[model samples]
Target: MAKDELGYDRIVERQLRGVAREVLLQVGSKGLPGDHHFYITFRTDYPGVSIGPTLKAQFPKEITIVLQHQFWGLEVTDEAFAVTLSFSGKHERLHVPFDALVSFTDPSVKFGLQFELKNQQVELQPADKPAPGAAKDEAPTALPKKSETKPAETNGGGDAKPATIIALDNFRKKH
Candidate 1:
């Protein structure tokens, strides 16, 4: 492989993200077929994310939401998506930008898509106790440092790995 000069655009990555978002849009517009459901993990503090104060306080860092049943108003746009989910018996709308997404998985068919957040790296860790008065509402924080970010693995025996994930990585030419 030839050396890639500086300022090289990662068009393939962008297209992959687009394809993932398009799939979600289709699921939203239509509906999940058979036992198919989504396990969407995203950065709670991303710029375009909007959750209730309680939810933000609970999941101050990153959160995973399931889209199988008990969801409504799933609207998908070019940049972000919004849906109403029941939390603690209350319906709350969540706005998550596609860039903020970390991973999307459907365990039924073992399908998955992982995305890299722009200018941000997210490292997953155990949740800590909330600080004093941390429950107060606040704006989304800046993207976490790259050092803290880690890619999720789809390892479970040998058959659990999604073929799409491997195929996409192979198609990308590393620089």
Candidate 2:
């Protein structure tokens, strides 16, 4: 195999991360548009990740967060993004560097991206399907897209209501 002297893989990774950063900046300022939301997955143990000890323990390897209704303090920078999320009624703040990201997805539009880390270097892959070893029970059930989510109308089917909020597992492509 020829040596990758120019390091195109690293360049591609940086570019992909930039895309995520730009998307985050847009959402941070304007918030999600229409039925759009985000499913952000990252390596919990990666350098520059900050989460409460409980969350660290629970998701020692990785965790995916949903940014729909319940998230707050969405601040994005060139390096990382920070936000607060509710986990089982307790609010927790998270700091995730773009380099630590495993994937990013907007299932409403059927768009996604996957990242690979090999020896601390980065590579990007299409999120049309999750990369190998990406499957795990990260959430209670598989995530829901806007159309796929339909909360039973407790108000006796009065009017159609959009899905309030859901996270990583809800973002999964239904098999």
Candidate 3:
């Protein structure tokens, strides 16, 4: 098969990231219910990744974080996800761009996604309008459109009140 000059081979690869992004957005908006959990592996050195010096020193190149019992402040955007996790008794926040992601897995459902390393930054298009009654506090420019991709299905039906707040704090640290 002839490779398309338009980088068509990478279309599915890029869509895979969108799939993972949708999952994270659901988890952020609706806390993981039952046995669902995620294992997100990402490149540490990618541009826009934020990690504490201690954790960065430990996993200098790449790290896998589990989202199961004790994660806080998960904010999902079109291009990236940020969450605060307990590490050595400290709540360390991490920011990882989807383009920088290496893999995402939901072992409980036998679902997983792996992305090829795309060194360049992936600019996110503005997300669709926020759901009705969504908090007005969020700045208009930073929101990621949620309707552009396949909607996450809920067994219970209808939108559930998000159990957690989508706090957008300390997204990236300046060097």
Candidate 4:
């Protein structure tokens, strides 16, 4: 097996994360365009993940958040993004670092990215608390399969297209 002294895999992963970040930055500035929504899955326990204690207790491992409607405070940075989403009528803020993301899916367009999260290193931040007496809405879902965008999930169109999931494992060193 040849040694990847240049760390090509890591480089590719960083670039992919950058792509996700760019998409998010645009959405933050202008909101989701058309029926294009997002299913962002991230590690709940990862460093820099700031969510209310209730949410942490519920989704200890990970969670998938829908970013179509009923969300606010869409802030994006080079490292991470923050937003408030509704989970069963309870509104909670979440701060997820890009390195903690497992996948990003926009089933409407059948475009998805399955990240190879090798670099979990992120700046630690304080846990976020729910707004005083603020009730949540609905969005948080159990971390579904890495790339399961079923035909029924795609928004109204002539025919649903199979999701294209880009996974880096296919290009990684076998050894």
User: Candidate 1 at 97: error in angstroms?
Assistant: 0.5
TM-score of every model versus the real structure: 0.72, 0.68, 0.66, 0.81
Ranking according to lDDT, highest score first: 4, 1, 2, 3
Tens digits of per-residue lDDT for model 1, 28-78: 889878877776778898998999998898788787777876678999898
The number of residue pairs in model 3 that clash at the backbone is 3
Top lDDT prediction, candidate number? 4
Q: Tell me the deviation in Å of residue 12 in model 2.
A: 0.8
lDDT of 4 by residue, 99-132 (tens): 9998888877878887866545422232233323
Candidate 2, pairs of clashing residues:
143-169, 143-170, 144-170
lDDT of each: 0.68, 0.67, 0.64, 0.75
Worst 10 residues of 2 by lDDT: 134-143
CA lDDT, candidate 3, residue 173:
25
Query: Which residues of candidate 3, in runs, are more than 4 Å off?
Result: 120-175
Please tell me which predicted candidate would have the highest TM-score against the true structure.
4
| Candidate 2 total steric clashes | 3
Can you tell me which runs of candidate 2 are displaced by over 4 Å?
118-175
Tens digits of lDDT, candidate 2, 70-165: 778999999899998776666778999898887677656556666665356432222233222322321212223334534444332555444333
> Residue 9's C-alpha lDDT in candidate 1?
40
Model 2 RMSD in angstroms:
10.8
